[model samples]
Target: MKSGEACLHRLVDKWLAPATVLSVRVVRSGRMPAQRARFVYIEAIAPSGSRGMFFFRHQDGCWRVFPPHDARPSLCVDALAA
Candidate 1:
């Protein structure tokens, strides 16, 4: 499994421990056309018979609970040589 996927699993295990994961789906967000999957949706059932959905986003080469911020254009200054 990829590092990002592994991170997602770890997150699920940490936050949703003792819960049974029902399904996991990966889909790309239209906002970030350059990258692969921008988000992952997971469906799980807890020991208490409660169902919940989780969303994970790909950011900084790993999976995170929050979405990545949009990249903005920036200007860079270069030094001049004689």
Candidate 2:
């Protein structure tokens, strides 16, 4: 997994512990939305990128952040683009 994916996984773990992350795969990155922050978008790959966005945020001085899962979704994913 790429560094982004690794970071994403960790965030997901912290936020979705019992929920289970299965895996994280960054497909694409986008420009930093004109916000000068510690993180910025590089590109948006597609399916994986779109899926990954759901669990991303800007937290603790970092972007692509994932908070703990407060609610469960209809689906759980263990792959890049499920």
Candidate 3:
């Protein structure tokens, strides 16, 4: 994994540990137009059978999980299809 991916790994370890990584599907990914950001979509399923799409942004050598303003969930699928 690259540094950007490493940041995501750290995030997984921070928030989603004590759980197993059942699967991860990279639905979409690309560089941001006119910006220092890269977007990635993840279709993740945990060992407990939970599923969701996580939207992440890699910008300026850091990945902070996207849409930090939302209180509902840190991840969703709409971004993956964007």
RMSD of 1: 5.1
| Candidate structures ordered by lDDT, highest first | 3, 1, 2
Worst lDDT window (10 residues) for model 2?
Answer: 36-45
Full candidate order by TM-score, most accurate first: 1, 3, 2
Q: Rate the local accuracy (lDDT) of all candidates.
A: 0.54, 0.42, 0.58
For 1-82, candidate 2 gives per-residue lDDT tens digits of 3555446545544543433334445545443443322332222234333233443344343435533233345654667475
Comparing 2 and 3 on TM-score, the stronger one? 3
Each model's TM-score? 0.54, 0.28, 0.47
Residue runs of model 2 more than 4 Å from their true location after superposition = 1-8, 15-22, 36-51, 54-60, 64-82
Best by lDDT: 3
- Per-residue lDDT of model 1, residues 1-82, tens digit only: 5654647677766665553644434333233455444665554554555444445455545766666666678755553332
Off by over 4 Å in 1: 1-6, 19-37, 51-53, 57-59, 79-82
RMSD of each: 5.1, 17.4, 13.4
Q: Candidate 1, which ten residues in sequence have the lowest lDDT sum?
A: 23-32
